[model samples]
Target chain A: MRKNYFHPKNLDGVYSVYQIEGLNQDRLIKNLKNGGLTLYNVKKIANHKMSLEISVKQDKNFFAIVEKMCYTNLELKPKIDKKRKKLLKKGVIATKSECGYNIKLTRVHGKAYPLYYLFTHVGVLIGAIIFCLGAYHVDDYIFSFEFTGSGNVVENRVVEYLNSVGVEKGKRFSEFDLNVLADGILAENPLLSYAGCLKRGNKMVIELVLAKNGTDILDESIKSLSSDVDGVVKELKVYRGTPLVGVGDKVSAGDLLVDGVISHKDVQIETNVLAKVVVLAEFNYTFISQFDDRETHAELLAIESLNLPVEYSKITKQPDKDGYLYTVTLYYNRVFVAG
Target chain B: MSFLESVKEIIGLEQFPAPVFRATIIGDVAGFFEGVVDVQTWSDEQIVIRLKKGGFIINGKNLYLKKYCAGDLVVCGKITSTQRI
Candidate 1:
């Protein structure tokens, strides 16, 4: 006869075991069915000696009810073998006979899913959301300009100059040749000594250092002098030699504004100090103007994965009349200066 | 072994006095009685044995068998019986 026994290798869900005595065959079968135990094979080896094999699905608390029911049986002297006792000592294993039908019941009850799969799914979703947000927040393309020296220049004139040379605010710094732009702006105004253009993060900065022109002085040899240009007298300074013109007198260019010689008694002393004065002048001029009134837009061009370049609208000027016109151009760039 | 040789061996040429030399304690010098090349005699009742680091002074009241002189070896015990090297 071929002897057949339960194979531990094949029983993937067996965790622990429990031995029970004084249970009638009929009562044991009834209890097994009521307890939701799915018996795989039941063989009666001898008088009251039976070998029962079963299986169950994996769950966290599948054998809890069976454990409680077995404890309540007062007449049952459960003698567990060494293997079953060792499994019971571990405290988490569900025996084959107790775990069988309960495994199916738990499937119906909706449980038993791998935890790693759930965590991985959540991680992927979070990663995708973060990636999208980063893409939206990134400012890839940037261009700007800046100005230096005295900021008290006419705004419209600078803007006009910038527009004429295609160096407007929204335009990319790389589009304009910085050296050529500097030369053009300096050519328009001889008063500016050095003009520079550069690019910073999202901005273009332009710097202009003004020429140091000497102020006009007056000689005290003149009898009287008055201002030729209309202006508010800001300051009046006196030389120690002689008075060419008294207080409250306005003088123009090429006029003897002050006297350096002083006549006292029989000696005439010549002083070296030159008289200086400052006046705030406002020159008023008018000319006809025309504007496109069209909204300007920018276009971005990616140079590489990290670098981006941009372009802007073109500007054209139309002649209106033969008169004095003030044109101001402001070109912004990002720049650094060593002090 | 012969009796004479054993007797000579028992009574070694080097004699040691009782109350073997232990250690040294420095204090005010009691007046000097005599001075020699390898030894010095003090008027006080103790004798001092000089070492490289310090000196060991022995009291006359603890002196047992051997007589201590200004230039004597002043042996306290056999060299092997001494606790120090």
Candidate 2:
């Protein structure tokens, strides 16, 4: 669509700048014009050197004519357009070097942001927003649950207990209290020495530690007998010590039920004694739980290591007029420590 | 005219026109039909273009041959005036 302004009908119009050097350059111009090519702005700076503008579309014919005329040196440079020529006249470029361009900005006004980039790549911003929203929403609920120390615990029982306590799938993890879950699972399971509840991302991990059960050793090392659970006494027998709790008496765990210091004819003899006490009917608990490490599960482990008459305990929760009612059931009655 | 003839005339595809040398002079641009024989004098202030028979001395400031084809010459500069020789 671009036609030469001068020879609009004859010349190809696409101009290119070239430096031509040769002897008898005046003859070269005549020869080039005769060769069906248009030359513009031919400047004869010297007898042998002339800079000129020629249509690039006639490049083949121009080169052939130059070669035929024996013009040895010819170099092509970038054509300076009208706009760039105007800028050159204004001396906008204060310095020039080959390494790089150090642009000097001048007279820029108005406050603006790089909103062009955001507008150009809207899909990336939308995708990032969606990812963040998905992450935030997914974090509110636990997706999957994994069990450790599964060999000693029943998986179905754990799942059932979780569902019963409203800790099942699609439930918000933040809604259920972790400590309540840990203690609830710990108190119910006799074999699990520790129960830990931990939430990682969308997955719930429960770690249970199995207590090591051994034969009954009536070692005289145990100084006195202590109650292992908070429950009413079902039966009691004292062979070598006086019983401080009778039947139907509610005693808390860690309470000394039989004392090592007893009055033997007012002699104040201090010696270990043997006693047997049974609390609530024995029961077994199976559930999923997680224990982080030794330090955190110490309290749960301490309860199990006591090795008292109550080998395990279970807690059942119910809604009553006075908020929630928690019932503690002590079971797994073993022979009281033969202290 | 036919569509084909119009297209050729617009693209300069038709054969060259008659050789009667004519210069269409404008304020700063002067175009000539039918080429000059040779450039007798060329400078920033003056240009002497030789024709087949006679020539014209165009005296101006920054006068140069804007383009010169087989028989077409375009002279562009700040023209004070022109004279025939």
Model 1 agreement with the true structure over B1-85: per-residue lDDT tens digits? 7774576569873354322222322232121212111222221244444433344444433222121233223232212112111
Q: Candidate 2 on B45-64: residue-level lDDT in tens?
A: 78777887688788777666
Clashing pairs in 2: A196-A290, A196-A291, A206-A289, A206-A290, A207-A289, A207-A290, B34-B71, B35-B71
Deviation of model 2 at B6, angstroms:
24
Docking class of 1: incorrect
- Over A1-339, each residue of candidate 2 has an lDDT whose tens digit, in order, gives 996544322333345556654455567777888888778777755555566776555655776765454433232232223543354456542223321212111111112212322333578668878999998988989889988884234444566578778898788888998878978876666556777888988888887777576233557765678877666687677778667888888777787778777787878876777766766544333222233222323334434554444555555555555444444444654335464
Kept native contacts, fraction for each prediction: 0.00, 0.68
| Candidate 2 segments exceeding 4 Å error | A1-13, A45-48, A76-339, B1-19, B28-35
| Candidate 1 wrongly placed segments (more than 4 Å) | A1-145, A151-156, A214-339, B1-85
Model 2 Cα displacement at A162 (Å)? 26
What lDDT would candidate 1 get against the real structure? 0.39
Question: For each candidate, what's the DockQ?
Answer: 0.00, 0.40
